[model samples]
Target: MLFSFSLPFFLSLFSAAQQGPAAAPARVQPSAKIEWRPDRPLTWEDFRSRPATDQLAALTSSSIDAKVGCVDYVFSAQVRAVFVPTESWVRDPKRATPQLLRHEQVHFDLTEVHARLLRQKLSLVKLDCEKLQPAFNNITKMAFLTWQREEARYDQETNHGLNLPRQQAWEQQTQQRLQQLEAFALK
Candidate 1:
């Protein structure tokens, strides 16, 4: 009787084992929905109508370094894309695709967010030039590094090369650095 009872238990266990572990609940990835405000797309005229000061402010505030007072700081829609000869071998320069524009726009937007956060931190900490200068320099460096990464990704995507690895590495590094900076700034 004991053997008979144990046999059924073993058989049930074996059957369950054959069925394998319960399936993991399906995971839904969040969608990245980018809303394009201008239906006509960004144009040279659109850039020119904006005040130079406002344009500089936008760029500077985005965590990008642009001398606001300088004439070169002006935004020009004509400058649709950025290219580096060193990475040209990996990407085609002739491919001035809309996706490239969108990629640059992401950089621009990220710069703005970084700049705003830095300023807020500076104010919160009551930092003077002497104290804030180093932090400012570090943030600038980080922005440039991020810019380079995005540019490389643009090239990779445009050339039909796999950039997932590079993108993931960048995302990890950026998140780590941002967290470190936030911690220091908060203190």
Candidate 2:
């Protein structure tokens, strides 16, 4: 009788021992849905043709709603060309082919979602205009920094040796600031 009672406890203990520290929490899925529209490709020409305000508006409106989070998110890419290492190295390394463009578009989509989330959180905080201004500025700066880091990382990893450590550091710092902003917003 005692053996039978001890068996279940022993098995429970064994199972607990077998399990490793809970797997590092699963990464948060990008809180956005990406939709690639082959018909509409954003080009330098396309961007240049529009007024600055219009360009910003277009970028903002490109986001689609996320089903899971009920939040607006954009995550799609439209590739126009490929990155040729030899040609890229000689001239403008910043130039992107269709595939790179697509990859970048996805990054933009994620950045947009992150920005939107931050904005929503800020509004929830209901700070006075004067008090909110600094926070808002910080959020904007952080978001841009994050976007630039992401873009540079993508470029470096995809292209040959475009490593910008300064950008990486900026990204890390901005991301940390963003987290603090998020926590503050939530409160």
Candidate 3:
């Protein structure tokens, strides 16, 4: 995602003082990111590398950015998903078990869901450059709020994917929702 996140960095942003016009914030470190893959589910092996010894667990994040243009009466926006491994990381390898991997996988899957939703909406509605930014912003805001709420609910409902029955429910729900939005799935 064009958005940057790391437990420490995100947390630090909260603690650090606001920057004034004269104070440009320090540069953020680059994170190693992977694109969301439909064929491959995450595995424990994927959590091997830890960028920093931050006092927190992993955080999965996604975002959408689109380019809009028009020709005569036709309007089009190409929406895409951005996943960043830079901000996403494992706090402790030992704690990264199969269940944890599944939890992380769900986060990525939710991202794909938003991407598909955006695609479906774009296909049905036309927005020229004049109306592009606001339209894209509105959609992105909705997707982001949904992603945040669902992620929290997933953790709460499943106890961070620790509860077997609850975790399965979230998994099935995510799968079903993905299927419902299959028409706009990524290529």
Local accuracy of candidate 3 as per-residue lDDT tens digits, 85-158 = 45555554454555565667777777677767767877876655567667666766666676567667777788
How would you encode candidate 1's per-residue C-alpha lDDT over 42-158 as one tens digit per residue? 211112122233211111112232221112332111101111111111022233333333333343333333434443443354323434345444544554565556544533543
Candidate 3 versus truth, CA RMSD in Å, comes to 10.7
Relative to the true structure, how large is the alpha-carbon lDDT of every model?
0.29, 0.30, 0.57
Q: What is the lDDT for 13 in model 1?
A: 5
lDDT of 1 at 30: 25
Give candidate 1 misplaced runs (Cα > 4 Å): 1-63, 66-95, 128-187
Best by lDDT: 3
* RMSD to the hidden true structure, all candidates: 25.3, 22.9, 10.7
Candidate 2 minimal-lDDT segment of 10 residues: 5-14
Q: In model 2, which residue pairs have backbone atoms overlapping below 3 Å?
A: 34-75, 79-98, 80-98, 81-97, 81-98
Model 3, residue 12: C-alpha shift (Å): 16
Give the CA lDDT, 0 to 100, for residue 101 in model 1.
31
Quote each prediction's TM-score.
Answer: 0.29, 0.32, 0.71
Q: Give the per-residue Cα lDDT of candidate 2 at 72.
A: 31
